[model samples]
Target chain A: MTDSITISIDGVEIPAETHHTILEAADKAGIYIPRLCAYPGLKPNGSCRVCTVLVNGRPQTACTTPVMKGMVIQNETPELKRLRSNLIEMLFVEGNHYCMFCEKSGNCELQGMAYRLGIKTPHFPYLEPKREIDATHPDVLIDHNRCIFCGRCIQASKTFDGKNVFQYIGRTRNKKVGVNADDGLGETDFAATDRAAQVCPVGAILKKRVGFKIPIGKRIYDRSPIGSEIEVQPKDAGSAQ
Target chain B: MANVATNGKRIVISPVTRVEGHGKVTILLDDDNKVTQARLHIVEFRGFERFVQGRPFWEIPVLVQRLCGICPVSHHLAAAKAMDRIVGGEKLTPTAEKIRRLMHYGQTLQSHALHFFHLVSPDLLFGFDADPEIRNVIGVARKFPELAVQGVMMRKYGQELIKATAGKKIHGTGAIPGGVNKNLSIEERDGFLKDLPQIVQWARSALKLAKEYTSEHLKELADFGTFESNHLCLVGPSGELDLYHGNLRAIDAGGKTIFDQVDYQNYIDYIAEEVKSWSYMKFPFIKSLGPENGWYRVGPLARINACTFIDTPEAEAARQEFKALTGGKPNAMTMAYHWARMIELLHAAEKIQTLLHDPDLQGTDLVVKGERRYETVGLVEAPRGTLFHHYEVNEHDQVTRCNLIVSTTNNNTPMNRAVEKVARDYLSGTTITEGLLNRVEVAIRAYDPCLSCATHAMGQMPLAVELRDRRGELLDRRAKGVDAR
Candidate 1:
């Protein structure tokens, strides 16, 4: 007989593997747990802390935590939601992320997560960090004020290109991403084709020279999340039926 | 001890550890100190260049950006430049140039920070004998929290700038052959200006820390110095220092200018490739002489040495301090690599400030729309060294030919020589420990070479390294899969 582990997510029973974390099992069973800096092709960085879920009453990142048997996961608990909203608030204020002027206005992961969590206004005051637009190279650009330090670009540089181009520099609140010796992109060994640019989930490490080619409502990857089979359901689905 | 004739034998290192991409290094050594043959191999293969043959010129930037994760900006820029040249388009508005320079500066900042902090710092800060398990930036974080924090902040600032200027961080559709799609708002510019003072302060502090560290570890750095080779870089029209756009020039270790105005098309004339049977990557040497005699180095150390003077006052001051430390023009001292990096950081910050303060930055005329036609080459000095992207397009704007000479390629000979020196110094006298080999690898990593971008879209194959006995029997083998990780 095959071994199976039972788990409960929001009072719903589900079968899971023995090695799975409560969060993983819940996610596998179609439970929604918000996240940033979590990509399928990369290691879990857990920097955003947006995917926090309550497991046996403690908050945990769903991306890194593995599944365990007989585990209980609470994805949309009141506390968890509040924590997620607060995290979103921190991201909005930590950088000058004015969505109206942002190139990633409708398509940004940060913006999407905040909207999904009902973040109408940033509770914290804007920590307007003065940043530079380094478009020295014809291709890549870096804007410090919008970066959330997810380390995705760094990971991409290290893993994808085998080039350690993008890196996290500085400490909390002052932390930023930059090239070797903080040079301009045009001056780095970084190629115009490096995947480091793709690793950035936000607008922090953007393509140089190229902006706003596709008009609003014409960009790709703009459809509903449901189209991908990873459906987003209402908060209280069980009671609706 | 008997002298064994190990001639005609091959030694291959697959999945060259401590390198950015899937590549191998093969060496053929004789009984004497002479290296009979050496080749840097690129094992992973994909037909990316071929695949791009028929794609729309406008789409080439996006497609080429996927060539390497670390240097997407280079490819994106090159592709855009090529397309612009082909279409015979008008120049980008002054505002666009400023914004583009700003974004490029961000990339340089983040990329260099990654190299100095995450990839090579382990070898510098901790003794080379430190366990590989703990010999990483993570370890640095635990030990030297302040430095690690500085690195993180520096990298974040650059990336954030990229995001704010472009739409997305990666594969952003910001620049086209004609021009940029969006213009920067006053609020965004003002917001960025406000944070400049803190960033400048942070850079200064980081520079101080680096200087102190280098002084404290002078002996360690001196011991780490490897082979000496000629330097080549790009300089502005007035023979002033230039990294973004300039003419190519070569300068020997004796401070003599060797070649000037080396055209991009004639690169093959000055640079020759040597292929080894064991390794897939080819070693490129200066064609001024033959492969056996020619050797060249590029990147930060090479660029700083090649330039006569820096433009910015802050960078000039840093350069003066660097010269004071080296007691002359810094030549092959590997420790100068750190000094060169600091100087570049200062220059990048100062340059960014200058670009931001330009009155024309707030203008709306950024992009100049046009169609595609002729062939063109885009060249720049990446932080690591000189980079060239040459493209030829037909009437339909389809790429007919695409030739790229990346910064890593420019440093090929020096890299091999550095490896040989490290192997001889560290491995010859001591026992063959993985740490010793890793140290040799670390010397190469100091350049922060990117092999994936050098041979992009060639194939999807694993990089393998094999250690062989005198008779070519495999002693040890290591391989990494072909995923874009």
Candidate 2:
């Protein structure tokens, strides 16, 4: 077992493991550092800068940066909050996020983050990129319009399902999640029950015939804001990771 | 060309005011100052059909409500009903159906209250010929503070009812494909019940105000853009006024049935829309009568004329008095729309009161599904008129085609007729007075036209008036509430 180390975050010292990142350590201490591209048990991609925090007076992604002894980090500063909100808004403008009708509206992490961060509207102009929806799959759908290129599905498919179904293709602004198989998702060896199908943080990868199964008030984030669960964890609660 | 008024000049009121959306009126005058031609032009175009293509079928209900802010609940429910068919969920559970009804009634109550008090009351209370600045909602507030408060409170109550049932005041996702997403909780029901009686009492007072105003100004209002046309709406199983769900019913000026008990799913078989080059909106007519004379009136007056009796007591009694005014014939007076609207407002209040008492609203059986279908049509009696939503979903659950015939579109031809009638009766000299502008607006307001949904736009645009000679030379131009050259 790795030895535990103490790190000061926002003026409070918290115990962290030798290999734990700032986000993992903060999360274990009941502090939620907002993230989009990083998930538990998955390698931190640091593609989305929502969790950017000050570490030793330098900005670093809390998800990707490992904790060190006597390290001082600032997570909830006003500058960091604005920075995170801007990153969230950038994600909104990069895709066609129609939250009003989106099946994943109340349950979506991206939307829940926006609600939690008090983003009434995105400051950036909508790109409104015309993207094709691959509905050729009989039991799965990929609406590229709502894709944020977070690569969670890509990682989940490769790591959890032992299948290389999704990948990041293209470069810069045109970058998107691409399928391994030719033609469409229907032609791919993908199942609706796959971990990749359920790992999308947005409405991009949705199972067919099962959208909006949960009611409004009963949805995951309706009663509580995003990150509330992590924030309400016991101070010494064990981390899922 | 020969019978021209003042060298064939045209008086154009671009972007009519105090209405939901943007609209314009062009009145052509001959050399003798006779109004030669009048047209109410819908200048904005909402390509909602093209926008909806390729979107998943399930998204249609919540997606279509983006069309209008004033009556989003109407569109939401109408589209959801159509999607329900696509999902084989048309036979909704009791809880689902009741919740939807509650939402619709709440919408009607709020919409009617907003229109009557905020939009229409200014003209009625202060007189149509009053100064343009003082003849508005603020003026009504300053002069008749109590009436304004009543309107605000009534609107707020109805909105709260919608929020509780629909989940939000704006772009609600309460109604879904096949069923509602939520049931009215006991707590929400109690909260609304506490305020129900007050809303009903206010509705009664509003109805009385409209009734007295129409009676006092009967002579003047009789000739105020009044025309004999067909009236159409939905009627319940026993021919009661049903705003939420009912078979289609149409009545002639004499209250004679043109058609009754026709399933709205086959609405295309009976009703067809005509596209005129002058307007973006379509003129829907009874196919049997043809576009020439098949044009009919809808909304409050039409609803009152089409239904045999209202279900609720106070509204039923009010409807009787309204019908008796025309000796049991369809009331053709345009201004009588106010009185008719108030009656419906009271009916919606009474319906809300009754629905709150039902235990089904709290039931957990909120959804049902059966055999799936491809193409479907959903119709609802929106606050303005009958709104039609038609869609065709493919096997992949994506919408292949969509067609929406909004209430304002249904009343397109009738609105033009009203404008022409008002212009022909009021326009005198080339000098465009504020009274003339107000008169044209008053006539159009009778229909409560929502130009936004007709030619959809977001932010409010001021009403503009352009006076031009027959030679297309600009004479004088003025935009109300906005400084524009």
Candidate 3:
């Protein structure tokens, strides 16, 4: 009778509204789903299926599917786990990570996800692809080698700043996120002060001047593993807070 | 690319170690087994200027610090100074200036500590002829455990000072255009006071060791990487040594001032960069002297040779002794670079103690807001030598052009020259011992060069983890969504 509906994710029940996606509801309930290319508060575009879950014996993206009353969702199935691990592996093999010497290793989400998943070594072979570094911009650096094509910078640039400084070039495997200018970042209107520079999930888009200011062991994820901040609570568990 | 001309066999020493990043020594040998030419090639390519174009000029102060891990604060403040002009100001708040100076001194201290204790000491203590595998900090620790500990502790203290003053140990984001974002707290200043005596004593002891090393190897040191070259530095109006801010000064091999207090913006009018066919790094020289004559040295030895006095008592005393030893003339002996580095370590410690007590250091006024300019140049004496950052901005504060000449590149010609001399003197076709080969590396390592800053890269990736049950059934998942955290 109430506007709020109950949904069963795995075996636990979570309360959510009709407009809420399974991801949004589960996040409020403190149950997590791994994701890439799904920035919070941005429009839910299922770009990376790291957030896949089973609904009624079928796989669905947790970021896109809306919650329905009495719906049963299995978020952690062996098959889904395998798919995510394989996807992470595919990404590793498709690019040159150079994790041994990367500046973003400790703070990198991709590297952290591998650790969280207990990936001893990438199941796939290393590709060691050579990528260009777009250092044309005076305040930002774009190392295409580290890019996973998440589109966070492109999305933030367009949605928040009303600036089309970044866009995707090419199609499918040939695709890459690029700046507006043809020559380099210097020719584009990419502002160093823009939110786009800070939204990079990897070391692809980085603000300059801060070179290893904080040593490796003292970094954010180094202090606490990623996702340790999210705590699941019942919808009505305001008393605990 | 043409496999180094002449009928000579190419001898390549890839990645001369004990320094940061990647570099190679290529010596072209003629049929007579004599060195024809030696090139210290910087292979890494980092196009920093090209990537910073679209970014707003103000953001560059924090961004360009990524250029080098060894002396990032130099780049941070240099960029901030360049932006200080864009913000249309010549003076920063007293507290901000003091804080920046403190950070610079700390950068110098930690860098010197790393170079002296961690990198060069091993070779000096154990001798270059020791087993190659064991000739490192590990070897130093095994040989002289107490001294090794002192070096590590001194470096750690300097790093903490950097963190307290700059807001982080390395690429601190505390500074902005026109001024800094924060001031050193009284407690923070007091924290360093407790360690002053120990740091000063350690600096003096290091200097003593350096003197001993120099005395023991007088004949070898005299011949090792010793040559005549012009020296460049930044000196105060009174001709005193100044690292944070100063006028450019160039001293010839005879210790005569070639140029005094020249405008940094017009560096191109005097200093010119030459690119060889083999290297990505350009050789910079005084434009008036031309490439052949202009190739000069900049760094500790050059700074010590060009300056009048240290201003601090202890370092000033050491300076006098060093002056007497070099005969009041420029010490072009590349081996003296270590001694000069030790002297600087003393000066940096002394400067930090003096700045810690300045009343204005804790003042609240840190920044000034103003109208923007189109172009400006920022200059600072980095731990290695002088660093220059130039920028041009459009109406919207977005960058239009950028040019950065780091300290190491300034010494490219000298480094190459040193390598050639060592290769010619020590290396031969019939008896190419590892020790002889190491001397070539030792020549390059003398500069404590940081090549990673000269080259650059970009990176990306994603993360996800799914927990499962038996029979491939789902249970739960923990994910740091690419954007979630």
The number of the candidate with the highest lDDT is 2
Per-residue C-alpha lDDT of model 3 across residues B1-485, encoded as one tens digit per residue: 00111123212222356777666555556556566666676766778889788665656877788877788889988998888888765588898889889888988998999899999998898787777667889988988998899888888888888888766787666677778767777898888999898998999999989978987898889989888999998899888899898888998999988898888877778888888876677788898888989888988999899999889998889888888987899888898999999999999999998998898988988877577688888999888888888888876556889988788888888887898788678764533345555787688889887776644422211111111222322222222212211
> In model 2, which residue pairs have backbone atoms overlapping below 3 Å?
B4-B30, B4-B31, B5-B29, B5-B30, B5-B31, B6-B30, B6-B31, B21-B452
Q: How should the candidates be ordered by TM-score, best one leading?
A: 2, 3, 1
Evaluate candidate 3 and give its CAPRI docking class based on DockQ: incorrect
lDDT of 1 by residue, B1-485 (tens): 11112223323232444557756544434444333443455665555667566444666766677776665766666666556666555467787766667777777777777777777677677767777657778889999888788778878877777766555566565667766556667787787788777677766765665677777878767767455678888888666567666777887777677787776546666777777554344567778766776667888788777787789887777777776765665457665676677678768777778877887767788667565456777777777777777777655334667767778877776766666666556544212335545655666677778877666634444344333434444333334333312
- Can you tell me the CAPRI class of model 2? medium
* Model 1 lDDT, residue B50, Cα: 75
Cα TM-score of candidate 2: 0.95
Q: Which stretches of candidate 1 lie over 4 Å from their true place?
A: A1-212, A215-241, B1-18, B26-40, B223-225, B262-277, B325-327, B369-373, B429-431, B457-485
Chain A superposition TM-score per model? 0.85, 0.96, 0.91
Give each candidate's fraction of reference contacts reproduced: 0.16, 0.43, 0.00
TM-score of each: 0.63, 0.95, 0.74
Q: Which stretches of candidate 2 lie over 4 Å from their true place?
A: A209-217, A235-241, B1-15, B459-461, B465-478, B483-485
User: Can you write out model 1's per-residue Cα lDDT over A70-174, one digit (the tens) per residue?
Assistant: 667787778888888999899888887866435555567787777777789989888887665555555666766578888887887888889887676777766
lDDT scores for all predictions?
A: 0.66, 0.85, 0.77
Docking tier of model 1: it is: incorrect
Quote model 1's TM-score for chain B.
Answer: 0.87
DockQ preference between candidates 2 and 3, better one: 2
